[model samples]
Target chain A: MDSYASTRLTRIRTAMKDQGLGGLLVCANGMRRDHVRYVTNLNVLGSWAIAVLGPERGPALFIEDPWDLDRARRDSWAESVTAGPGLLDGIVRAAGELGLRGPVGVAGMELMEAGLVLALRERLAPLTLQPATRLLVELRLLKDEGELRAIRRASELADAGYEVFLGTARAGLPEYELVAEIEGFLRDAGAEDNMMILASGGVEVTGMRPPTSKRLQVGDLVTAELTPQVNGYYAQICRTLVIGEPSAAQQQSFEIFWQAQEAAMESARPGVTISQVAEAQNEVFRKAGFGEYVSKRYTRARGHGLGLHFDDEPLIWEGNDLRLQAGMVLIAHPNTYLPLAGYMVLGDPLVITDGGCERLTKTERRLFAVAP
Target chain B: MKRGLVEWDRQELPEGAFAARLAACRAGMCEERLDALLVYTDVWRAGHVRFLSHYLPYWSSGLLVLPLEGEPLLLSTQPQRVFPWIAETSLLREVRAAPALGKAAAAVLAERGWRRAGVVELQELPWGIYADLTAEAPGACELVDASALMRGVRLSEDGHEEALLTKAAAMAAAPLAALDPVGQRDWAVIATLERAYRRAGAEDLMLLVTSPTAGQWPGVPREAVLADGVLLQASLEYKGHWLQLSRTWLPAGASPLRGLYDRLGRAYAELSETARPGLSEAEAAGLLKRLAPGDGLHLFAAHASGSAPFTPLPGLDGIEEGMVVALHLGAEDRQGHRALVGDTFLARREGLARVTT
Candidate 1:
């Protein structure tokens, strides 16, 4: 048995044993298949899967198509991973192979369709099925060292991309055009996945998005939101800037956000629940009389998990109480925009540590002016 | 005269508006009575889904099942949080993880105790999802295709949607016009183009550009001057709307480029000729082909853009009156190189119409 497969099998075994589950099948379906990729190193976009952590013996990684068997052989170290249709049949067929049968726990079971669920019920007339969320969440929340490194790399590249963005901002530029340049730079800087949203129209403000052809005037509030992916790991960095000369109000807004951002950064630490992070931001905004914006005009928790998908679990919202743990990468931002009040954007990628949090990027969080 | 993209009233689309479209699909399903109509979409299949639901599904693939009658149910994956942002009608919904999609679907139908239901576009369903659905479906119920159901309503373009697209298409050139050429780097051209599209108020745009040399393979911008003789090809999209166009200028002499351009340009009748309902897709292709001079495939024009891209969106949606389309059929042969002429087109009920003619 390969090392990682054993590691996965052991974890699955523990999960089934812990949950009193007979079996737990993990899958990546639609946009949710990223987990399968995270575990197996196989980025199957077409909903491939693995049935792991059967109560008795262990688990089996299953692929939808037989064509991927060799890729599985080359990439996956699992000994019993197999291919083809009727995974439920495979689950039944491999029952003895797994050395356990009764009370199987299926994560994706309820999510199945009407007719198929009925048919599967007939097929699995003997066994039992439980909800898949808790088991899957258990496997996902714990990040391995390799995963941590990949996320760190993605974050560093994001910061470098921001540096390029700061250096490139100038007058007579369009919002989308600026983003394209940054995208091009990020691509060159070894970024594999990216979701960029930027905006820079000052007169009538709304929010941020991917750069548009809206030309940057002398005082346009250029906002760039970037998420760079390192091998499927997402790292987020958002920054706001001014075109040409910076206005006094813009400068003031930038400083306030800068202070607020530093405050939030300082507040992040291991053992602290995610709500603490939100509280830090809320404390800043509440001190400024923006307390009424909680869950309304402006959200209190703008921070969240930035992982496989740019936004992941454990959101930095008002009520979320997940504690910060080592190896968990979070995007902490205290972003709030009130109409006629200008912008307040402060966010950075951070990895939880034994004591405090470490920023993935070292770029200064102060508002910058575009050079001529 | 323009407005911001996101600033528009999302209510312009409204909740009940889609129900009518689905109801129309159900009417077609009843024509043969499909077990249920299956409309499938993934991150890759979002464009097709967007054609029905304004929400674009963001990243997850979604399935909307509408029976001949009764409430329609939408099934999708977990982390499937974006549904509400796009779902206005009570009709939209979500399923669990992707694995048991079939089983869940069957259970839903069996609970209803329906005997026969029709599905549309079953071919596009993911194989795993399909297999699971087939395996788990109630033995008493039947599943089949009713493609005619959705196709019946798919041809008609909505009023507000057309307005939004028209406004978006007009933006194709808005940023281009505002771009300053001097002292700008190669990436500046791309940036300028994006700004042009954004300033023009496009919702979600996918603009791809390449100088003549980069055609074989794609390349980033170079420090090249945007002067007269540059053959630039730009593929533009707004709100997942796809349009292709090309524009070129002749620094040497306007006569040759203009002369060659006039031949293809004739097909691009702005207000004089508009694509209406009766015009078959083949006829529009023929008109574009005629501009090509020999069966409509070759070096006369580099590219053209609209619904199906160089080829219009398939099905019965030919040039219909009141529909907006891009008429990018122009060329410049000053240096004997192919010309890139791209523009927009609008279809009117009576006379020919062109929005950015």
Candidate 2:
């Protein structure tokens, strides 16, 4: 109906044609759900779902929950929304109605249960089911105007969460209470969901989880990765705070990561490979005599793509040579464990532009020293 | 020299509680003639894993392998970077940082020389991983669906689980006592509940807020100025057990729900009285339908709640003693005013006792 929806369908159809797919069974679970949301514009509340799309005919969305059927019809661009108390039957019905005969593409199959796929194979005999995960990921690689708007809003909410973190990280406050305060601020600011991990201690901290009853002590280093989702688009911001005056070793440990993150951002220009950006940060660590700590032993990832899902394609890590393209949003952080300061976190969301990139979050990046 | 949330600690199951669960699981494995049991869980469905192993995985996928005899192993996709946090929260001894699930599971089975293995809820496992396992360890081990075996052991709440459920219900109910509807928004109300629940040791929460204008349906928290009468409902999961809570904020004037709440409260009381060891699920459903006759009742009037959400729905067989159940009741007047009440009840041979108030 709308031009944007038409454009999206056309782009997907082109991909389907290129892949020799007459129909595409786009599956989404709680883990890999951006594809269905991208095509249907409906953020599925259920755990798993599928969208049956034909190159010529309109798409049919199959949802697990009956209550969600009404919401899907209202919010989704798909012309048909069917309730699938059992998803396999819904898929069969959609395929029959759409008359999709020939090779069918299945996306997000990794998240799909093995039994479901086997059932589909048995039920839809003679129809070839091919992997279409890459097609969907490529389509979502670049952000459109509407997606950018949602990502901007999500990033702003994450910034608001950081502000709350700054104000609440004080001595004697339990970690979970501070987590509650930040989460409360985000929810009140219209964040639909959030995944925040935080840990606070004096150099003995390992990582963060949902706020616990552990109270903060003076001179504690509080590190948190605050990822808030608004309208299904997630923007992540990782920041660290000191409960009181920071020690010399603590400040120095934070500076290493701050400089590394800056180096990564400098190489995040369009047309530059993601590995180049990672190399820039890894070089910083190596120069500082912390080269050995840059691997997975010390950090999970140097950074990763940010969008509807927390980690998208073109993950910014060593050996990943995917080139950076304009409109691709990323949360680049060189958060690693330091010998003296433990695990310190400092990262922000930014979007690749035609030239360089623009930071989406406005929270200050320097080590925040909260008053006791 | 000191800075931390020292008092803040994860709500852990007592060591004896874990030992009991392991004993029960091993007994089930023995009865089923299985050498090992593999339980897979993601964020959505994790009660099975959390019930046996004290590991509450939030972000990624995890597998808990319990052999017929030996220490259980936690196969975590998270890197060694999070091993410390995992160790702090879980009771599993050997936590293997496994990126590839199928390979890791196959290796464990091969190492233990397990010939027969049971997979809990085969329908829930990813096909890719199953294919990989079949390819990797063909004939090395035989896998069977043991979901029924797990359900038999975890359908009822143990003493420790019951205690956690009681605590979760109280935490979910605290924010409703003083919710000011005059100027609060829907998200603000939800925020209040989230904060209170987390502070009171809630691990997971599914909250919904609605009003006369918004209609009575669960949804994400949005900015809507609360009207005189607003309904706040939640299904809180605390330390792996669940309970339901619903409260209404009435304006100063006379409200239609004033009578409805009393009627629903009576229905809950009546259901608690009639619910016993021998009462069938259909019989309980009949009693709830007859007592709390209304237009706004969900699909199930009463169902099992511990470990899994609504395991045995209405029309099922008899309810067993020691089973934790969530009783949901609601009513709507002709003028569109609605009153909803839900709570967790433990069915015992002596009688039914409400755990969540």
TM-score of each: 0.60, 0.92
Name model 1 segments beyond 4 Å from true: A1-9, A47-73, A77-96, A107-121, B1-45, B53-148, B151-357
lDDT of each: 0.57, 0.76
Estimate, for each residue in A1-372, the C-alpha lDDT of model 1 and write its tens digit.
556556766786777787777766555554455556555665442334655545655446676544245455555544467765567677556765766555766665433333444454577667665556656665766677766877888888888889888877787865655665666566445554477766675634544433445567777777776888776778888888777777777776566566667777788887888887877777776676656543434433568787776777777876677878887778788776644335456688888887888898877778777765
RMSD of each: 11.6, 3.5
lDDT of 2 by residue, B1-357 (tens): 011111213354577777888888888889889999999866666678877876766677778889887788888887876677667777776889888887788888888888999988877787666776667764768889998888777864587777677667677667767668545788888888777777666676777776744444446656788765676667777666767756666666786567776776777667667767677667866875788565544432344433334443332135566667665555666665666666667877766688877
Report chain B TM per candidate. Answer: 0.71, 0.85
Candidate 2 lDDT, A261-343, residue by residue in tens: 99988888989998888889889889999998888777778899988787777688989888889999998899877787888
lDDT per residue as tens, model 1, B97-187: 3435566677777887877766555543555567667788888888875555555565455665566556555666565555454333444
| Candidate with the greatest TM-score versus the true structure | 2
Error of 2 at B306 (Å): 7.5
Q: In candidate 1, residue B132 scores what lDDT?
A: 67
